[model samples]
Target: MRDRPQSDTRERIITAADRLFREIGYQKTTVADIARTLGMSPANVYRFFSSKKAINEAVTARCTAEIRMRLEAVAASGRPAAERMRALLLTAHQSVLELGVTDAKMQEMIAVAMAESWGVIRAHIEEVDAIITRVLRDGVASGEFVPSDPEVTGPCIRAAMMRFCHPGLLTQCHDIPRPTVEQQADFILSALGHHARS
Candidate 1:
């Protein structure tokens, strides 16, 4: 029960920061602004978050949590491995685009978050890779895909789709044409000696 208020205070700070980030670019939003919006002193906000960086990390984590949830859902599904992989890739790409691509303000916020909260971002990527590795391991067990090292292949797969899955890459490649999701999935499945679903 003691933890509840602390949790709520953190949530309130995050909520205020998120609003400020959206209204004003992250570069322009300060800790004081967040505190002011919350009707609290900057010192009070600091009591909850050690610094602006910590607040940024918390906000960034919240943003990426959406994508992680989507990927976890696809990974946990009863669908075939190839199908799940395909869905996971598509879902991840879509989530990145939704969170950072279409909105200019959001893109700026994401770029800052990526730079400021790199450790958090890297951990999120590893979490995502673990989920993919699980699907690949299951695929091998089911004979749906060729026997290969999921631990090795997961990062490779992520690399190949980085342009689609990475927020910065998504924005960078916006005006450029790239392989469709089906095409990429097919290429991966064929490389693994399995037929990709249509």
Candidate 2:
């Protein structure tokens, strides 16, 4: 029971860190800022996380977990390969929009994650790609899809989806409707040589 409070505090700290990193960005958000956001003292915050970098890592883990959860859901749906791929891409794109990109702080955290937390980011990418690869491979094996190297195709598909999902990239392509999650999924399917289902 005593451990429950500690766990709650830790969760609160992580949540605060995630929000602040998205709002102000990792580079500018201080430990104090997170502490204040949590209505706690800096020292109390330190008890939860030793440094801003640590908090940033926690935030990254949380974000990666969220992504994995969504990907897993699509994979478990037992849909056709094209449908699964579309679901995966659209879900990812919606996540980006829901998370929003207007926060300079969040952008900084992502930038830092790309550079400093490459291992963590790479692991997340691999996890997501693995799901897509499995779907593609399963489709081929079941004679639902053409034979292809999933190892290569998965990453390429992910790259294309990422470009469409990225905040920076989306902003640049603002002319596009930004589409609903379903629409984005259909678009990805179309791009991958699959006809969109009615």
Candidate 3:
């Protein structure tokens, strides 16, 4: 019989790692723990990933990919740029809030991911910036936004929404009377000249 494909094995490893990370926190989860979950030796898992860090990166990628799918859908929708922008931010903030509120362990995992600057997390941020850039670019083309450099403007939007976008901040602000996503979106829209700025 042929052996399992490498991709299949790798995905299995990532899936198991994600569960363990959610259960035990990234700091406590081990390669051996992941291997045991798969009923394999740590050496076998190593054939697919070099270190525990790699496993964590894969898990992080998986989580962020889910968020990207939603953002991409919002970007591709036919709604007006202003509505799309609002949807994008709301979708992003909601994803993190849903995950954080539903899974308490996820916040711990996010803290570790942030502390280590995981490759997947960095890539996720860049992709998110790209999505924002796409919306801003379209808005400018449609005369809904003031013309500006999307490269510059996208990061600015990300920075302005940092409180709503950052996972750690989202969790901490859960109890506070923070601005709603719509309110933040309106401020961003105003800055984009969606309304007259005095």
Candidate of highest TM-score: 1
lDDT of 3 by residue, 33-149 (tens): 999989999999999999887777777777789889999999999999988998998898887676653366787777767667566778898999999999999999999999999
- lDDT comparing candidate 1 with the true structure: 0.83
Model 1: per-residue lDDT, tens digit, 1-198?
566988899999998998788789788999999999989999999999998878878988988887899899999999988789888888888887776555677678777778788999999989988988998998889998889888899988888788787767677777876587657767877866786446
> Model 3 clash tally?
0
Worst 10 residues of 3 by lDDT: 95-104
Model 1 ranges with Cα > 4 A deviation: 1-3
Cα miss at 11, model 2 (Å)? Answer: 1.4
Candidate 1, residue 187: lDDT: 80
As a whole number from 0 to 100, the lDDT of residue 69 in candidate 1 is: 93
Residues 10-61, candidate 2, lDDT per residue (tens digit)?
A: 8899998888777676777788898898899999988988888777777777
TM-score of each: 0.91, 0.81, 0.89
User: Could you tell me the lDDT of residue 86 within candidate 3?
Assistant: 82
The CA lDDT at 61 in model 2 is 78
Clashes of each: 0, 2, 0
Candidate 1 matches the true fold with a TM-score of 0.91
TM-score of 2: 0.81
Which one wins by lDDT: 1 or 2? Answer: 1
User: Alpha carbon lDDT of residue 43, candidate 1?
Assistant: 94
Query: On a 0 to 100 scale, what is the lDDT of residue 109 in model 2?
Result: 78
